[model samples]
Target: MASRARGLNEDGGFVKWDWNKNKYIWVSKDEINKPSKPGHSKYAWKDGNKVAARRPSFKVPVKKACRQPLQVANKHGKMKTPSPKKPSRRPVHHKADFIVPGYDHGYDDGYDEVDEKENYPRNEKYNAREGKIPPPPELHSGHTTILSVMSNRLIHVNAALTFWRQGPNEYISYVIRTEDDAATVDTLPALVNCFKNKTPVSKQLSLGACFELLPTLKKLLSSKFEDYVKTSLDTLRTMLRFWWNDLIAHRNQSFSGDLQQSRSVAGIYMSAIAMTDIITKLCKRKDGIAKKAEIVGTLLAQL
Candidate 1:
């Protein structure tokens, strides 16, 4: 028979834990080796004083994993399946100005998603629904010119600043007449107004406001200060175009790589905006070509 009770002591004696004494006590090895009583032998055991064979057990069944599909919210707050198709290079017809993913040149430019959505063109039909005049025919077409793209981008930036209520107060006085005027400008039509014969409200525009209205500011300042205005405008446009191309290149190079590059792109974009303001001030002072050249050099070096 096998010993099934207690453990062997250092002295080679059988011992078991004593709850009352709080220590191990000696036990009789012969008594522990005795067979269990016949009445308690219900479970089959191979030898006396051995634990009965373990009862067979069945495992609980596992259920298969279930996953839900992804969904996106439309402008109307309705949930719909995300479209796999890329946004058309042309204008999209929609009831509201909705921000569609994969629209900004189909690559991340390091600007936050908010900036991407804010920079998009205003939906033409959405404007008409609000009882406002639609923009020019060319602006609504599939193929938009580089000048138009730049102008539209500036307008949208102003509109975004207006939406966030961070735009210069001078903008309100210049654009707003009655209290009922629309909060945001109709972009394309507003761009057209920049080239019109009417003078921009120079007195109403501040440095910060001038940065927001680049195309119109060129018109405004060129009228009063012609010396550096034209050259500065050309330089600024070239700088913006180069910066945009650089962003596209960086996006291609580092799409799946380091995020630090993305952050740098965002910083450069903001720096360009700051440079625009600096150039505006320079134009206001009629700063000579030498100073403009130096500033342009510095701006290019940072890129």
Candidate 2:
């Protein structure tokens, strides 16, 4: 006798198998008398030495497509995970307060107040009261002013010389000559004395005397003397030298004093000397003697 195999079903029921028939049998202890359904038959099986008459096959029924068991997923309840936080925004800064008014777009509330003071007027009262506008102290003619006085002196000398040349018998002529000679002679001495004594002849006297005497001497000597007219030329040269020295002294003083007149005086002195030299040369010839006085007189007038 062969032993039979047995297994438990899903419901914890026992399933028995017969080796000879190769079939499974189900036995219900609670209801053993239930009839098998159609297409299934009862069967006899021997186990050990005992025989069982009626037994049902243990095959389960084929399930319909709609009746099949559904697959159920076991899902854990949803966990609450926190969302990541966003980073904070930085605060915006405004520009500083000390910015200039026109440039700044923000508030100007805290600035200091500025005080604007009006300017005072300048004091012109003293200037106005003094009438500080006298005719620019007459700008004395540099050459003319000096020459005028010299001219007057020479006139006086010439008158006296004229008088000395004419005799008393020719009373009218004498008077005229005496008057001219006195005038001309008088000027030369006065000028010489002024220079010798270091006394300054007024600019008028200095220039005038030179101008008047130069032509007169030239004229008088031209008739009798050639280029080397010693007596008259000596006198004229002496006078000119003295005048030149005086002018140089005046120029030095002016320079020390920082005066503008010194420049003019110096220029005049140079011009006069040049003119004198020209005249002397011009009248040096024998033919030139006749016109020497007239030419010299014309030159003086021009000066």
Candidate 3:
């Protein structure tokens, strides 16, 4: 007769946690032997069959064996089969900006059954929606984006200081990683505008606002800067060709990726052209990115 009882000096069978007692309690009345080796169980399935002198368990029939079954049985209770609900699909609206990712999956746990619903996307134009540039970091939004809009044109600058000054140690690195903007002569008017009233606003940007955009650029370029520059220069040639073709496109959407994804690949090329042109003028300045590029190139060669 199997009976549940508290784990006294002799634990009958497998012990279960008793939350009320705050100690392990034996749940069965079977006579079980404890392991001799410290923290090791002799009845453990791995060496459960091994006897006092390496005697096999199969040689001695289970009917005449010492160890009894650990499993507890309830005659009244029956195992249940989970009946999964059929998932219904909604018609795809062509005007929707996003794609539906996946389907719904909900399973049963006894009487408790949950019906989890799926998510919806914005529209059918996937890249057009994805390619849309996000808002500023310092706004009421949840992001700690380093890039903040400067002037009417989009300019990426270090906005980490903006958030940190507002509160404690709060800065976002993703906004900085995606930044490609470097200071140039064309930005002089913007920088000067920022210093209006002899005191620059926290929202405005200057040469000081532009630090190492990508931290990895410094570490990785210490050894691979020259190679990266060389490869970038080669890639720049191809980008220029694509940019020219895109510029000469009769229809503005001709250079778009696909029917669904209307993302233009020429935007970065145009930004690169603007920066390269600015760096050409920055060559005259003592403190310019062109010199930094050369320094990095030289350091890469030395390393």
Tell me the lDDT of model 1 at 264.
Answer: 49
> Candidate 1: where is the Cα deviation over 4 Å?
1-211, 217-287
Worst 10-residue lDDT window for candidate 2 reads 113-122
The segments of candidate 2 whose C-alpha lies over 4 angstroms from its true place after superposition are 1-206, 226-228, 249-259, 262-271, 275-303
Candidate 1 vs candidate 2: the TM-score winner is 2
lDDT of 1 by residue, 1-303 (tens): 987676445334477876456699877755667765644232233344333323221221226642211121123356467889987786553324444344443235554443444454667444544545567787757565666766765665565456334323444444433221222333223322332322353223233433344444244333444443444444354434434565556555566665554454655555455555545455445346446545554554444
Candidate 1 structure lDDT: 0.45
lDDT of 3 by residue, 74-187 (tens): 222345669898776763433233223362323233322111111223341333344343344457463333334342124333343344344211222333444332322122
Which residue pairs does candidate 3 place in steric collision?
A: 96-123, 96-124, 97-122, 97-123, 97-124, 98-123
Task: Name the top lDDT candidate.
Answer: 1
Q: After superposition, how far is residue 65 of candidate 1 from its true place, in Å?
A: 99
Regions of candidate 3 where Cα sits further than 4 Å from its true position: 1-224, 250-266, 278-303
200: Cα error in model 2, Å: 10
Better of 1 and 3 by TM-score: 1
